[model samples]
Target: MSEAARHELPDLAAMAAFGARLAERLKVGDVIALEGGLGAGKTTLARGIIAALGYTSEVPSPTFTIIETYDAPPVRLPIVHADFYRLNDPAEVEEIGLDDYREGAAMIAEWPDHAGGFSHEAACLSILLETAKTGRIAIARGGGDWLGRMP
Candidate 1:
């Protein structure tokens, strides 16, 4: 494990800016595992990332849908946004064809712990968000390839 980088997001805008920075470093096969409690800005951060990728429309939370996908043109690359909050087991990932959806795309995974987590991957960037009095605190820990590329 590498040293985690800490970010202070004093407001929504700051969060979005951080998300955009992360977006600039995104690539195929990358897995961004967002960890946080409810209302910790996980979805908000994910939306910012998608928007920075060139998505002009509203980015909804995948809490109910479980998964949402964005392709190139509207975005620079394919992105799979998934919320695993409802999953009872990591094995459910196979049932939902998560691998198939990730075939050629990078993924933004919320509640990743429910799906076993992607921290083991060389391209995985695990961001843990904690609500603070002013806004939020983000502790980001990325794998080998992402160590020097963290946003």
Candidate 2:
């Protein structure tokens, strides 16, 4: 895709809008790997997607729990929200049955580096957040089929 056609989300609200838009296009077995620095609003974006799906409960960060499962109505599959920040090795991912989560569910993973090569061939979505004097800049990069649905 051309640079001019790329999506740019200026702030948290815009990011949320982007997330909501993405939610509309999601399907079971889809994987979204989120990459960003600390305090980059990764959880905020996840919250938007979850809330857009009609979930009313608090969407907590999976930083400690490693993963949180959400069951939103009207969808046949559950949404798995995972944070691999605390993982020290890729093998730890297997202990959690990450492969099982890969099937029949939509995954939103933060700090995905800990998952190592698991995201390979999966629709990889990268959200990079940069801070500026005026506000924050959010850039999205995706490969595979996500390129057409993003934004």
Candidate 3:
């Protein structure tokens, strides 16, 4: 386990900027696990990442659909955005062909604990969001190329 570093984002724009920075460092097969309370901006951050990746369409929360796939232009690989808040068990993930999404995809999972454990030697980047007096606090943990660019 690695210690998380805290970042202060005074506003939504700052948070989105942080997300953009994170997107710049991501590659296929990367996994971002988000840990945050309701309305802590998990989806907001993800939206920023998708937009930064050149997705022009609206990026909606995957709460109902469970997962949304976006194809990376030119690269041809996919980005899997998942929300497992409604999951009853980790095993339920298998039913959705979650494993199939892992190959050549950057996965952003909100409520990743529902997946039990990451099967591959996936680069795990955990993001924890909290409410601070001035703004929101974004905490990141993990050792990877993208980790360094977080804060």
Candidate 4:
């Protein structure tokens, strides 16, 4: 495991702030793997990143559709938001054309383990979220490209 950093999010606002902070350093080809139990704010943080990138439209959860794509121009870069919770096997990822969707786009993947994990990817950032008595907490572990850039 790579060295990790912890951030305390007292509420949805704080999580949004963290996501905005993360957006400042984002680039194409980055993969964010979000891991946590139900209602852990994975989608919330992903929304923050998308909003911070200048997307004004509603950001819906990809739970059923599996993947959602946001084009560039309105945003600085293309982004792919995917929810892999429904997947029963890693092989299902290929059927969804994840690699094709990921080309030249940053990906925020929920339940990434179902998609075979992103830790091996050079620009992957894995975040584990947990509910706390007050709110929630996020622990981020970054791969080689994200080590020094983790917030």
Candidate 5:
């Protein structure tokens, strides 16, 4: 079974703080699978993670381009930020060379289900966001590799 943790995102600031915590433990080959309905904070948390990674510029939504990459110096490590919302099929992931972009890098994947999902990976940290009466809730889960790493 996967390990799981819960977080309360009472506000954007809290969500961003959680992102920073998540970033501290990030490493190569890790995949942060973000899941939720539209406007449920998937992209918001992703932006937070990117920002915590040391990316100073704006993080445009990958809703159009599908994928965005950030390298070292600006970021502590290489990262592939992908939004699979535009993907018509899981096979499209291959066509776009998703694996190539993931080489030697961590990934922040939005709409991961559109790309066949990444939860199968031991290092894949899947975060499911749900809109709450007040703000939002984050449910994070992972495999053995994330046993003690679930933030």
Candidate 6:
């Protein structure tokens, strides 16, 4: 059965730490769907993961570009950071060649619902982020790989 893990990030540092931890467990073909409203730290979390994986320089948001690809060596694994917020139709995901991007690469997708959702995938991890008085709350849920190593 699938399970959920909740984390309270009191600050940006805490969120980055959490992201780093999650990055350690990532593998090829894994999908991390980030769901949150504006300014919810989805991009921040993605930056943390990319940085932790050995990526240097800036991590750009895919808001306009739709998808940003990062390869190995600079990063330990190939990864794609994508945003579907601008998609007018769910079918637009096909135009972006999402499956091609996922081949031997982990994916971090924001506004996944706009891309028809990734939760049905057995290896998908859904992270719901929300603002709170203290900082931010992150709830992760899904099956496949993360079922055993969740915090």
Most lDDT-accurate candidate:
1
Error of 1 at 106 (Å): 0.6
Model 4: residues with Cα > 4 Å off, grouped in runs: none
State, as a TM-score between 0 and 1, how close model 1 is to the true structure: 0.98
Computed on alpha carbons, the lDDT of every model, listed in order, comes to 0.95, 0.73, 0.80, 0.91, 0.91, 0.90
> Local error of candidate 2 at 23, Å?
0.9
Q: Where does model 5 exceed 4 Å of error?
A: none
Best candidate, TM-score = 1
lDDT by residue for model 6 (33-144), tens: 9999999999999999999999989999999999999999899999999999999999988898888888999999999999999999988899999999989999999767
Q: So what's the TM-score on candidate 5?
A: 0.97
Model 4 lDDT-worst window of ten:
142-151
TM-score of each: 0.98, 0.84, 0.88, 0.97, 0.97, 0.96
Instruction: Give each model's clash number.
Output: 0, 0, 0, 0, 0, 0
Evaluate model 5: give its lDDT.
0.91
lDDT of 1 by residue, 1-151 (tens): 5788999999999999999999999999999999999899999999999999999999988999999999898899999999999999999999999999999999999999999999999989999999998999999999987977887
**Tens-place lDDT digits, model 3, residues 1-151:** 3567788988989988988877887878778788788888888888888887778778989999999989868223478999998899999998999989878898889988877744234387888888888768988886454445544
26-82 per-residue lDDT for model 5 (tens digits): 999999999999999988898999899899999998889999999997999899999
Candidate 1 overall lDDT versus native: 0.95
Model 1 RMSD in angstroms: 0.7
- Give the winner by lDDT: 1 or 3: 1
Better of 3 and 4 by lDDT: 4
